[model samples]
Target: MTGPGNPHGGDAGEKSAPAPKKGKRELWKLIPGFAISAFFLWRTIKSIHYDDLRSLHVVQPVWIGVMIAFLLGSYTLRIYRWWFMLRRSGAAGFGVCSRVLLTSFAANNVLPFRIGDFLRVFTYAGDLNASSSTILSTVILERLLDIFTLLAFLVALLLGAAHALPPVVVRGHELNVLHFAEPVLVLCAVGLILLLFGAPLLQRVVESVVRRLPAGARTEKLQRWALLLFDAVLKLSFAGRVLLLVSSIAIWLCEGMIFVSLSRMLAIAVLPRGPWLAVALSNLGFLIPSSPGAIGVYESFCKAAMTSQGAAPGISGIYGILVHVVVFFSVTIAGGVAFLAHRMARGAASRPLRADLADLPVEMPADLPPGISS
Candidate 1:
């Protein structure tokens, strides 16, 4: 639970000093992501034309409100999903969970490497006096649910198409969506199979490795943490798993509606399926390491998806920027506000997070994993 790099654990008053060389190494690592972001950002900007500004003159304002509504709805569902998954962990209620969730997302927007997830788990665990590993398990499961659902969506979109979808052109190269999707689909299938069926084998493998290692505290902790995460999928009840899947689909659909509303507002002509494709591709694009908030990567993916479906390049570029702006500011502002409110409610006595790895259990929860009701 300790703030990332601190192994022995420390409190608010005592902080670990990061090694300069390690810091430099981390900074060096970020350069590639920054370069990638800059390149894609340039590509996105280059795809736009000043003449496209003329489209702004006829923009519809009503869809803006609709987009905001659906965007909020998406976040609401996300909070519910997380809360449902961790409610039994002695964590706080929906309101507290919602604030933590948004604050974490806001952190991800501004900070590199999705550090917000760590913040969410550690901070909430500290507050609840519970096991960070258990909370972490829920997070791992949430991610798997999201990945599975997104891949399922891409497959549905491909199969549901009336005709063959056009290849996406990137830097003069035409790439079929299937080419990208098929491999991902296979990977997800293999991963799901391993998770659902191969946990025992994996546990045996880990045990064998651990048996050969020197006996030590670090070794035991590492084994426990690894197994906890690996077993996350199997921890959930059958019904709880079903609910998570359904909610994930609903969450993405809400986001898709946001894109649909954006297309409507921008008055960009798109195929009936265009908005969904844009939503799927743009979000999946986040997987690529890029700048905070996925800056250039998002716009590039959205523009590509829109353009591939017959929208004008200029209009697609505009739409991409517009949608990103809406999505980014909405979460950032909301998270900022939520973080402030939480701090204010706690008063001035609140201290920096003190992560105690001792809070992590050596065994998984015996009860139904957080989401499922007994």
Candidate 2:
């Protein structure tokens, strides 16, 4: 059933117009995330003593260049991974996928709980002719796969580092790798089990709860859509799941290499395998769902990871600051240029849909089924 001027007019009476006030509440709901970000940034800045800024010049330009290269490479890999995921989700066209990813990253950096994520879904929806809800569901599935990959990598890194480094040879600083291993593995296993089966369970629970709501066609349709999305997500092919997992790990590894390069460029002692751990930990911090670009959280966590690895506080702080600078500027410049080009091309391609609409036949076919309407 559809209403007058509805794209699909049907036997059902005219659909009610949407309430103008329905979206007003959304503006208010955005305040908390932004407020939290501001508070976090303020506290982070206040916590940085002037002494932490000392020796900032130790980071050389050549090292900065290397770090920048690694950062760019990481972004490239991310684009590739995103393209793969989008294609698997029936969102074809590499160019559109790349643009969506680049713009999403840019939006994430600019907007405050990374609202750019929703923008990515919207962009993909327009480009792929797919539903926003479906695209968003894929994103959720992607994140779940990412968490599993991160846990697996963390466990492996801990085990390998334990064997490679002597327990007490490096002074009283005892490397308690084993201490963290059991708990981390247990958590990873639990998370994996949940990802494997928890989604379907969650859908059933949600359906039961939604069923108790006031009965109506709209409610029924919403529940049906929710179930459909869950089923589509749960039915991801084994190969597609494996691809997501592998790509997720590869993207993180590339990012770690970038961090390690940046650390070295800053003349910080490059731990043989420490950057991998640092990257894993720092990226995990970002998953905390803080502000846009994870400004305060990223810096604080990076510094902490470096400090734990025996780096001088000042040097680590400087490394964190410089890496952020490089990444921010590089992405901003590149993405801005791409965005401008995309807009220009879109403007050139756009044509009036009314021109084609006017050519449609006015009379309906007599043989058409009674329930079928367009």
- Whole-model lDDT per candidate: 0.75, 0.61
Per-residue lDDT, model 2, residue 29, is 52
C-alpha TM-score for every candidate: 0.80, 0.67
lDDT by residue (1-374, candidate 1, tens digit) is 12235444367345436445555766887798899989988888896787887756437889888988899899999999988877656667888788888988998898766777767766567664456666777777778777777787776787676333687799999887677777777888676656556656766777889889998877776676656656565555667656766788899999999999988877778887888888888888888998889999999888887887898888888888888998999999999999888778888665543332223221332323343311
Q: How far is each candidate from the true structure, as Cα RMSD in Å?
A: 5.9, 9.7
**Which is the leading candidate under TM-score?**
1
Q: Report the lDDT tens digits of candidate 2 across residue range 167-247.
A: 444475776655667587788767665555475776777788887999876676666555544644465566655565667
Off by over 4 Å in 2: 1-54, 57-66, 158-181, 193-236, 270-274, 348-374
- CA shift at 75, candidate 2, in angstroms? 2.5
Off by over 4 Å in 1: 1-5, 8-18, 57-59, 162-176, 179-226, 352-374
In candidate 1, the residue pairs with backbone N, CA or C atoms under 3 Å apart (3 or more residues apart, or in different chains) clash, namely none
Which residue pairs overlap in candidate 2's backbone? 3-15
Instruction: Report the error of model 2 at residue 264, Å.
Output: 0.5
